[model samples]
Structures are given as structure tokens and as C-alpha cells.
Target: MARTLHLGAFLHGVGHHSAAWRHPESAAERLGDIAFFEESARVAEKGLLDAVFFADGHSVNRTYTAGTTWFLEPITALSAMARATSHIGLVTTVSSSFWTPFHAARMLASLDHISGGRAGANIVTSMFDAEARNHGFDALPAHAERYARAAEFVEALTALWDSWGEDALLVDR
Candidate 1:
């Protein structure tokens, strides 16, 4: 058997460069449009990529004036993308620091079902003080603390995701 290389498209607004929004052909102004996201996913699918990844931040950075800084919520946007494409995986950044394990598990599980198991979660221990403040923290936790919390979050989330056995949702009537 031959090994296969999996590829993922990181779909950041237009491009990943800070000045991508300034490019003449960039669709920077359409960051909030679901159609824009759908098109991006479709293009990724056309390329035979295994997944399209969406990065997310919970707070508005001060750099907003320089370029495109915000976008549609990741999980919500991925739901639309799931509807728009098949075969390509849908993955989103979700901060363990800002969300409860239950919330994350439920959302991811729903997205997984929606995409026929093509959904993925890119969990992060967020480092921004602004993200901390938005989640009710006065300051960002120490790196070790953040990682510790992330470990627990992942453990709990995995348990929740596994709570449902594979045949739990059988639909015989």
C-alpha cells in the first residue's frame, strides 16, 4: 500500500499576509458573506484538498484599521461550508480558554454529523489578553496554566464526544 499525503487549505481572509486585504483582487470587504466562504471551500475541494481550516479569534484586534481583521464565526461559517461542499474536511479553530468542553463537544459533534464525519476541531490555548478579558479573565493565564487547562478541557471534551456510542442514534421505528 502506498502512503498518501493529506493537504489542508487554511482559508484566511483572501490570504494570510497582513496586507492581503490591500491586494486589488482580494475580496476583503466580503469577509462576512457566507457565499464568499462557500466559494473558498468549493475551490479547496476542487483542488482535492483533504480539509479547509478556518482560524478564529474571539476579540477584535487593534490592527483592524490596517486590513481585514474580523470574519464570520468559525463554527457557524463551517456549517454553511458543509452545505456547500462534499469530500473536503471542515475544520475550525476553537479556543479551549474561552469555551466550555460541553459547548465545544456539542458543536463539533454536530458539525461532524453534518459533514458526514469530515469535521475537525483545532483546539487552542489562546494567548491573547484581549481574548482572556472577553472570557472574563483580567489577564492571560501563565503558559503552563493555560496548557494545564487545555489538557483538562480536551479530556472532558473527548469524554463527551465518546459518551454517545456509535449505534446510539439508530433510527429504527
Candidate 2:
């Protein structure tokens, strides 16, 4: 197979750099606007980009005075993005530490159906004690434990995703 480069826009709030929101051309105010996300997806598609990815978090670890942080839940935001573009893949980070495999599988499966199979995921074990606290952990789990949970999470999601047969959702009797 021939090697090819894959480019995905990070599509962070305003921009990746903390100071980007201060730029004259930056659409900082449009962070929560669906049109902003839709327009961004359109632009990436027009550029022939391969995908647009959104990173997510469960808790606020950074002060707003310091820098921009992502607000929209990745799956929800990407679900909206899925509606605005035809070809660009919609990818997002999903924390295995916080989300159950069944929930992740259900949401991603819907996204895949919505986007004509352009949905993708970057599963993560997550970082920060704040995020851990939000999910009911007293602190971040040990590294080995987190990785082991992540592995199991992936296995469960894969099983859930592949569990259905073609007729699973059949309406015709």
C-alpha cells in the first residue's frame, strides 16, 4: 500500500495557542456557537483535510484567566459537526477513565452512522487529579492500573460495537 499523509485539524476553541484568542482575527466569541463549529468543518472539508478532532475534559483544571480550554463535550460537539460536513472525518478524545465502554460505543456508533462512517476516536486514560475527582476517583489511579483499565475499556467497546448483526436494527418484519 502507498503511504499517504493524514491531516486532521485540532479545531480547538479559538486556536491551539493560549494567546490565539486575543488575535484580531480569532473567533474567540464564537466558541460555543454551533455555526462556528459548522463553518470550521466546512472550511476543513474545503481544504481537503482528512479530519477534524476535538479534545475533551471532565473537569476544569485551568483558570480561564490563564488560557482557553475546551468546553463542549467531545462526543456532543462532534455529533453536531457531523451534520455540517460530508467528507471530513470527525474524531474526538474519549477518556476511558471517565466513560464506560457501553456509553462510548453507543455514541460513537451513532456518530458513525450519522457521518457515513467518518467517525473516529482517540481513547485516553486521561490526566489530572481534578478530572479524576469528577469521575469519583479520590486521585489519579496508578499508571499501571489506568493502562489496564484502558485496555479493558477498549476491549469492551470493541465487543459492544461489533455485537450487532446487520439485522439488529431491522424494522421490516
Candidate 3:
């Protein structure tokens, strides 16, 4: 028997389509509202989905459609979703181009622990000039350069994660 692949919904600012917010099916008004996300997770849970993934951006860009503009931080939003659902995994985007290794590791690990191993961090190399400016850089790095930095970033993150081995947590009284 072959194993089936788990389905994860990559939800963003109302829906997947760029113009989804303008559609009747979208809840554009609640893009930044915690309750909106909470309810959406609930719906996903009801469908027995494996996870809800949020694609993130570091900077605010021009919005041709009606929806959020780099608002409602992913980690914080996932933490809130963690409180609302139990079984569904909460996946958040973490930029290797911007965040330090230690911060990424700690934040993801903390979210994982909070949600009982149901947290996942989607690694990304920021490719937008706006994102670069947001991080105080004059411009976005070239693809190869970004990947080189990303390699180091991942290595550092793994080291940080390994710093806390499986048995490192001692809650014994």
C-alpha cells in the first residue's frame, strides 16, 4: 500500500488567489483580526487538514488587491492559532534572509513546544527590494548570494535546535 500525502492549505490574507479578497468567498475585513484566523483554523480542523500554512513577507508592498499588507506577524499569529486548535499543525514562514539563526530556532522551537510538536517553520529567502529595505539594506541580494547566506543561516539554526537535545528539558521536581 502506498502512503497518501498530507494536504496543507497555504492560506494568506483571506485566500490563495491574489484577488481572493475581492471575491465573495473571502473575509477581507478580518484579515488582521485574530478571531478571523481562529475561525478559519476551526474550519480547517473540521476538515481534518494536516496543517494551515501562512506565507509571510518582511516588508509591505503595493497591494493590487484588497487584503493585508505584511501585517499580523506570522509567529504571533500562529501562537494565537495554537491556542485555538489542537490537532492541526500551524506552519509559519521565517525568513532566512532577515532573522538571525538563534531567533529563528528559538521561536520555532518555542512554537513547537507550545503546540505539542505541531509547529513548522517555512524557510524563505526574501527576494523583494521592499523586504531588503525593511531590514535596513539598500537592496535585495542576488539569488546565489541569498542562498549562500541561507545555507549558513540554516546551519546556525540547526545548531541552536541541537543545543537543546531531546532530553535537555528537565521538568522534574
Candidate 4:
């Protein structure tokens, strides 16, 4: 059997560069448009890509002076994208440091069901102080502490995901 290479597109605010929004060809004003995301995902699917990924943060990055700074929530945006494409996977960055395990598990599980198992999550311990503040932390936790919490968070999330048996959702009507 031959090995296969997987390619995933990281959709970040019109483009990846901070100045992406300033480019004449960029859809700067339509960053929040579901149609834009749907089109991008469709294009990625046309190229036979494995997945489309979105990175998310709770707080705005103050460093960017001129660029698309805000965005639709990742899972929410991906749900819409899932409806527009059939084969490509939908993945999003979910900050373990900010979201409770139950919430994360339910959201991911729902997305997984929606996409017929094409949903993926990149769980992250957020690095920004602003994100911490938004989550009610006065300062970012120490690196080790954050990782420790992340480990526990992942364990709990996995347990929650596993709690539902394979046949749990059987609709026998």
C-alpha cells in the first residue's frame, strides 16, 4: 500500500499575513461572510485537500494595525462550511485553557455528527495574556501549569466523548 500525504488549508482572516486585509484582491470586508468561507472550503475540496483548519483566539490581537482582526467563532463558522462541502474535513482550534471540557466535547461531538465524522479539533493552551484575561485570569498561567491543565482537560474531554456508546444515538422510530 502506498502512503498518502494529507494537505489542510488554514483559513485565517482573508489570508495569513497581517497585511492580507489591505491587499486589493483580498475579501477584507467579507471576512465574516459564510459565503466566503463556503467558497474557500469548496475550492479546497476541488483541489482534493483533506481538511480546512481555522485558528481561533478569544481576544483581539492588538499588534495588527491594519488587517482583518475579528472573525466568526470557529466551530460556528465550520458548521456552515460543513453544509457547503461533502468530502473535506472541518477542523478548528479550540483553546483548552479557556473552554470547559464538557462544552468543548459537546461542540466537537455535534460537529463530528454534522460532518459525518469529518470534524477535527486542534486543542491548544492559549499563549496570549489577553486571552487569559478574557477567561478571567489576571495573568497567563505558567507554562508547566498551562500544560498540566491542558492534559487534564484533554483527558476529561475524551472521557466525555467516550461516555456516549456507539449505539447511543440510535433512532429506532
Give a tens-digit lDDT track for model 4, residues 60-137: 877743476548999988999999999899999988788899999999999998988999999999878988888788
Candidates arranged by lDDT, highest first: 4, 1, 2, 3
Model 1, runs deviating above 4 Å: 63-65, 170-173
CA deviation > 4 Å runs, candidate 3:
63-69, 169-173
- Tell me each candidate's TM-score: 0.92, 0.93, 0.90, 0.94
lDDT of 3 by residue, 1-173 (tens): 99898988777887766676788766878878998888888889889899998888877677543455546888888888989998899999888988999889989998998888999878899768988998899999899999999999989988888886778869998
lDDT over C-alpha atoms for residue 167 of model 3: 89
The lowest-lDDT stretch of 10 consecutive residues in candidate 1 is 62-71
Q: What lDDT tens digits, residue by residue, belong to model 1 across residues 1-173?
A: 99999999998866787888888999977878899999999999999999999888888776543466657888889998999998899999989888999999999999998888989989998757887888788988899988999999999999998898989977988
Off by over 4 Å in 2: 63-65
- What's model 3's lDDT at 10? 74
Measured on C-alpha atoms, candidate 3 has an lDDT of: 0.84
Residue 13 alpha-carbon offset, candidate 3, angstroms: 0.4
RMSD from true fold, candidate 4: 1.6
| TM-score for candidate 2 | 0.93
| lDDT, model 4 | 0.89
